[model samples]
Target: MFGLKDLIGLIISCFIILPVVTFIRETGYFIISGLLGAKNPRLTIGSGPRFFKFKFIDIRRYYHVYSWFSFDFIKAKSKFAYISIYAGPILINAAVALVINALLANDFFEDSKTFWNRFIFYVFYFVLFDAIPMKTVNGKPNNGMIIYELLRYGKRIDYNEDPIIPGTTEAEEEYQKEVEKMKEIKWKEVEEEETFYTDKKG
Candidate 1:
């Protein structure tokens, strides 16, 4: 038999808790990547086909709770891409945990490990789980594994062939923009290197 608190917790977890936490994580990725100059970085929430979708700035939010973050391969420099991808779950989880702790200290939540407490703990668990490299059930790499691979080999584990959201042509446009941005970045680097060499010579 579920008590009032339990029932309320269940409802909030289903409708609010999961969705809000997931949004914060995904949006963190989007914001960090964009600030790092990623071009058309596509941020997604949930795994399945999108039921509700919209674009904000350079982000596309898929309205569901179960979520992950991804970006165009060519969108960012390798280091920036790695940080942006890795920052989502880790940064948000830490920030949320701190806030939750403060709230609990203020008696916002009960001292016992209730639903709210457990929710906060679960968020922290997710951060650790993702930050530790491991493979998923289907043998695909998790975020930590991807970050490790990227740092070591300059490549990431290719989890899927089609990295596109269903029923959307955004990937195509994003790819084109990614290519153009990469080209620009490449030329800029080359020009900067030449200038540096010229200045050294003179």
Candidate 2:
């Protein structure tokens, strides 16, 4: 039966654990792409308007929901390189979860064992979904599907024009446009509210 403890756990999982795991997952891509000489790489966390950007990391307002790593171009453009890039998140998450599990088995972090266990569970959960070949809700192929297609057909077979990893430059441009649009909408709302007050005063 669901109770207060369950509710608290759910809140922590959604707001804290999941976001940290997501950042780690994206870090896998950032690390692999950097090693392969991806130019101007950027890691954007969450969607919607930007909150703050420092160095190559952009944190959005909704920081706990979605994240992605992008680059302008890769110096090593090869099938093997692409495969390594896609496999990065899966391998990294699995490695982290395994290491934690081993530590737990050795009587480490016993005081915070519950938190660590939950963290490991979410890590493996990400690995399981990411390592399976399937199409995502947006009709884009997941990393596993991309890797499988690459291995089997020697290329991506998706009809989607958008690249799996978007270019950082293009993404930034799109983000700026979205911000401007949002600003315009906010101004319109303010103007409407002001007009309503002015008419009431008359």
Best by lDDT: 2
Q: Model 1 Cα displacement at 7 (Å)?
A: 3.7
Minimum summed lDDT over a 10-residue window in model 1 is located at 160-169
Model 2 lDDT tens row, 1-202:
9999999999999999998899899999999999999999999999888889999999899867598999999999999999999999999999999999999999999999999999999999999899999999678999999999999999999877789899999999998898899999999999999999999999
| TM-score, every prediction | 0.61, 0.97
Clashes of 1: 0
Candidate 1 regions exceeding 4 Å error are 1-5, 43-54, 57-64, 68-75, 106-115, 157-202
What's the lDDT for candidate 2?
Answer: 0.93
Error of 2 at 60 (Å): 1.2
**Worst lDDT 10-window in candidate 2:** 59-68
Tens digits of per-residue lDDT for model 1, 1-202: 8899788778877767777677676666766766766554555555433345456323323444766555544445666566555756678777888898788878886755476686786677778877888877567666677778778877765655443212124554654676688789999999999999999999
**Each model's number of backbone clashes?**
0, 0
